[model samples]
Target chain A: MESRNFKRVYVWELPVRIFHWINALCILVLAITGFIIADPVAILSNAEASESYWFGTVRFIHFATAYVFFFNMLLRIYWAFAGNKYASWKAFLPFSKKRWNNILHVLRIDILLQNEKVHDIRNISVGHNMVASLSYIALFVLALVQVFTGFALYADNSDWFLPDLFAWVVPLLGGDFAVRKVHHIATWFFIFFTIVHVYLVFYHDWLEGRGEVSSMFGGYKFIREDRLKKTPGNTKEKSEQPSESKPEDNPKEDEIIV
Target chain B: MATKTDTRETYYESIIKQGYSRRDFMKFATYIAAYMGVETSMIGQVVKSLETTYRVPVIWEHFQECTCCSESFIRSDHPIVSDIILNKISLDYTLTLMAASGHQAEAAKHETMEKYHGDYILCVEGSVPMANDGYCCIAGRSARELLLESAKGAKAIIAWGSCASNGCVQAAYPNPTEATPIHKIIKDKPIIRVPGCPPIGEVMAGIIVHMITFDRLPELDGLGRPKAFYAKRVHDSCYRRPYYDAGLFAESFDDENAKEGYCLYKVGCRGPMTYNACGTIRWNNGVSFPIQSGHGCIGCSEEDFWDNGPFYERLTSLGGFGIESSADTIGKVAAGVLAGGIAAHAIAANVSKRKELKDRNSRGRDNEKQLDD
Candidate 1:
């Protein structure tokens, strides 16, 4: 049996871990609340629920979760500057000539769908590779936009704080009705992306055994001894562990035979 | 109060000069008080007020709008709303109603402003166009200039309809003339905005009555609309609220549901979100509002309401089993299984309110007990 005790690198910080889990919860709550508000599915026809209105309750949940999502976003943005190299802006963009080639190669594959195994782990950093980084950025943008349009919709009859900030967008898309329609449609995008995102997380976790899911909450992960220590082509990752001994330049290619 | 008394005497003397009888004046007083939403007991006060106070000078300006406000004012629900508000009070000048033409009409308006200075009401109907130096001009004076000059001397400005309030439909997208609302231009003067495609005649009269009787503006909402008249959403007092709650919305205007007087939201009614007195004060001498006339509320009273959306197509967020997610949704259903949902909602609301009250009382008692201890 493989010994449970192994060298574990502390990759994700505590704030990052908390941010990940809280964001997941907030997304789930927001999604459920959003769909419920959009289309209230009645399970029992005869039963009348009167104490709290469905719209009111769903709206309360949506708004509360939105606050969580908003705070998570703010902290995440802050962490980009304050975090380690792996968790910072350098991790998010394709910079090197090798990665530029990979981006083009990946773009080709993205258009012509391929299995996830075909992608090279050695060619990229750990947290999020170039493609995944941009995808994360897209999601971040979507989340930020969602907060804006969400607040605008909420501000339709309420406080001016959100409305004043985003009032210009209401007129940009024709008028209030169009703005409302765009907001309603954007909600569906977030929902669809979230479904795919959760599925991918579980699939990758089950396949790679990299402990990706657990790392988000626990802030550590176990890497194989044979795998490249300095993120393969991405040598910038060397700063993380100052004391770990360098692997032999050419260790014999050994397959694990438990 | 003295200003009111003086205005009242002035009105009595004006009518008396015009050879109107005391009985006619008293009859007009009762009619005006009732239409103004004053109780029958207040008729004596209205009579005393009108009998004692003079008619207020009014300079009515017309711009990029139909003079429906003046039409509605003249055909008001109150007999005096027309007589006292328009011809009888002898409004100093209005473009549409005034018999004088060209220089005479201009001279009369100028005379009212120059004489009354700060006492006359400036009733503006329609939007002020702000293209060129204002291409929309009246008697060689740009509508903007005329509005400013008239407003400069006025005590209060009453934006009579949606046109004056939010530029109405004229200020919608691609507005070539740059129609602007009255308050947007006049920062110094106090304005009371009465927005509606054409406001309910009685409501228009009521606002005037409140101003005249109270000798001040009526209590206003955040939107600068009179609270007594514009407080409740059209949905709140709508006759079809029961139908809406019962989930019996009219699928289409020609459907059986429509015939049975169901909620018209599915067919483009903005009633659920729009606040106005149409559902209560009604229109056409208390006979009916638009909803009663088999038309969905157009939300003509709200800001940018003209551009909000098509009148039909139910709001995505508003419909469905509204109570399904409430505190007692499931609990109340169980309560109904034991009794009935009707009883459950009532009992649950009662129990919840009771608990709330009890908790509040307990907290208060705890504070008192703490002091005693």
Candidate 2:
């Protein structure tokens, strides 16, 4: 085993991390309560109907969490402009030629499993890869859809101006039933996205030996010194690059640390 | 030809002429005002309007319908309402109810169109079939021609039932006849849609009385339904709503839950999505609505409700997919495929990584051996 130099780079900002965790929690709560609301379990009690507000409580939680989810997304959108370069909106949207090229590279190496070797360190992303960033963009759009449909359904019972503004969404989609169907199906998409996202995060963490999982929490990712130097514009914190030049004397110790 | 009288009879005079006393007319006024959701303070105003205003001329047209709206209107609980509104109070032409038929009915309709030109209310009880150059015809003229001709001089239009308000059964999927609602045909006029399969008789009466009292269309919702009647969903006002909130749904029609008056949401009730006054006004003179009689609401009044069914199944079915599959079914199948694909990808990733590692280890050993030599 050879010794290697590692540099820790700040990736996800504090607002981004907070947004990610809160958004994840909100989706989990929304999906569970949403499914239950769609097909409720019959809970029979000898107690009077007035005494049992179990379904109402479930709906209340769903509605309240939905507001949190909506506002959290708004905060994230604002941070995309205000946050650091790695957390910028430019990274998510595939407008530039470099981003499109990176997307293809990711598709070949990571998704398709075409090659295990990265021929160039410059192709490695310190922040989100093109594919992950693209998927996050898609997720943002889906979240908007869920919000619109959710609030539109809420409009029927509510007199508040905010929910009422979405009343046109009902007739536009044909009816209340259609809106409910779209909202329900979009939930399954979140489930699918979560499964693939968690799996890929673990895969990348194991494959690259980068602090992928912990980076989300502490907002720092460990990059090899050689790769960090090769990655253009990512070497802004040159003073922070030469922190640890630890020797890989034992592979077992490296495994335990990772 | 019918004589065009300059002096039109007031609703009070018409009701009085129909062998009803002033007291009966007042009772009828109060009954209609309550049903119309008019404020108690406005009851006197309603009485005053009925006394002063001349009876509004009505031209009732039937097209691709079964005449159920007419049947419902005649069977209103208040005999004076049906008797005066349908028979005496200047209902110039109705194919189902008018005694004058053939040329006599046609002449009477023409007379009202000429005399009351822009003052007559056109009540359409059926959908107009647009396919095959208007397949549904009346008196040797196509329904479209008759509708357009009658609608041209009307003060306002009233779409009486689901047949006229929505396309109803005739406009369901693969509608060969291409039946269309009145609102789609006449865009200029203020069309108030009172849309039940056969709207509650009292509701029909109440709308008419509202028009007479207010001398204009009642306040309407986005769907052009009277806000007073169609403001809340049937589920919202339903007596079984507490059961639904409590999650005590009837599993089957024959279950003990059914006997205990549980909510019928599981057995395909459309009350949650359907907006109507069925829960409050009820049918058969407020005797019992469908829910009270232990049958789930079929959502007959909503648009494309005929296509949105198998009336006995819950709303989980996705009709746009061409096949009748529930959202859960499609979602489960997709999830299964995704999970299987992920498992396969993970195995491939691990195998490729292991091979890469072995190659790297051998290459490192070879380089060390070369250095030693």
| The best candidate in terms of DockQ | 2
**Top candidate (TM-score):** 2
Which 10 consecutive residues of model 1 chain A have the lowest summed lDDT? A249-258
Question: How close is chain B to the truth by TM-score, in each candidate?
Answer: 0.79, 0.92
Chain A vs. true chain A, TM-score per candidate?
Answer: 0.73, 0.87
Candidate 2: the clashing residue pairs are: none
| The 10-residue segment with the lowest total lDDT in model 2 chain B | B1-10
Candidate 1 CAPRI-style tier: incorrect
Chain B in candidate 2 has what TM-score?
Answer: 0.92
Candidate 1 lDDT by residue in tens digits, A61-115: 7887887788788898899889865577656766656456656654443323233
Model 2 lDDT tens row, B1-373 = 1124647778788888878999898899888899899888999999998887888889999999998898888888889879878976589999987899999999999999988889999999999998864498889999999999999999999999999999899898898899999999999999999998988888888998899888889999888899889888899999999999888888789988888899998888999888889898888777889999999999888888887776876755676665678778888888899989999998898786776656656756866776954
Give the distance in Å from residue B333's predicted Cα in candidate 2 to where it truly belongs.
Answer: 0.8
- The segments of candidate 2 whose C-alpha lies over 4 angstroms from its true place after superposition are A1-3, A116-118, A227-258, B1-6, B320-324, B355-373
Q: Score each candidate by Cα lDDT.
A: 0.67, 0.83
